[model samples]
Target: MFGDLMGMMGKLKETQAKVEETKKRLDTVLIDEKSNDGLLKITLTANREIKSIEVDDSLLEDKEQLEDYLILTLNKAIEKATNVHESEIAAVAKDGMPNIPGMDMFK
Candidate 1:
């Protein structure tokens, strides 16, 4: 009936708003990563925006070592951020999803 359709539409709108809010919240969620020896450190938001980088004095002496440290540390930080981002968005989307009859099969 048209009533059910209208209710579903309203629910969808509410869900969308929640999802957007969750995304904004994720901007403050930070993920930190460091090199094995503590020579390099990285911090990024769940949205994958770099927040800071800390490098030890020893790392500056060797360009290649610094590059390697950057590559590894940045990669690890990005991976963690990606995981956080995906899980958060998925949670929001799944929670917001309307329970249509056939949709249960996808779960």
Candidate 2:
């Protein structure tokens, strides 16, 4: 019936609004990653914005050590950002299509 179709459409619109809200909230989530040695660290948001970088003073004495730690820390941060981004995207997709199973229909 037409009425039933309209009702489903309204529900879909509500779900879409929820998905948008989730995406907006994700912009506030921050994820941090650091090296095991604690000599280097990076901070990022779910949106993959580089918020900060930290390096230990002792490592400054050795350029190579500093460079290695920086690279490691940067990689870690990127990994963390990627994870957070995936989770946020998943949440939005789930909200948009809770009734559909095994459907990869969103970005």
Candidate 3:
């Protein structure tokens, strides 16, 4: 029983290490999205941290258009980032857990 407990603790530690590594990798993962024929571009990390935004000079004169494009582009970037983040977390979870029927549904 003691040996089994120690083995489980070792596995838990390994999983924790993998989770930390995944988090660091997520910080470096970038998702870029554009809107309005590429008039607006936004870059975000897999963690949904906004990294940069690029807007065409032509939209500078139109605040409403700029706002609309910015909103659309930002949403797209966030959505993409969210999908990537979820997939990465799911990968980690699947790696740490035992294989079971319908296990993926939890993710």
**Counted clashes in each candidate structure:** 0, 0, 0
Q: Can you tell me which runs of candidate 1 are displaced by over 4 Å?
A: 104-106
Residues 1-107 of candidate 3: C-alpha lDDT, one tens digit per residue: 68776776777688778888998999999998998598888899999999999889999999998988888889888999999998998788667754345655644
TM per prediction: 0.89, 0.67, 0.83
Instruction: Predict model 3's lDDT versus the native.
Output: 0.85
Best by TM-score: 1
Error of 2 at 67 (Å): 1.8
Compose the digit string of candidate 1's lDDT tens values, residues 15-43: 89988998899999999999999989999
Which candidate achieves the best lDDT against the true structure? 1
Residues 1-107, model 2: lDDT tens digits: 68776776787787778767766776788878888977777887877788888888898899998898888888877787778777776766665653434554653
The models' CA-based lDDT, in order, is 0.90, 0.76, 0.85
Looking at candidate 1, what is the lDDT of residue 64? 96
Superposition error at 71 for model 2 (Å): 1.5
Clashes of 3: 0
- Model 1 lDDT, residue 37, Cα: 95
Task: Let me know the TM-score candidate 3 reaches against the reference structure.
Answer: 0.83
- RMSD of candidate 1 to the truth, in angstroms, is 1.7
Which residue pairs clash within candidate 2?
A: none
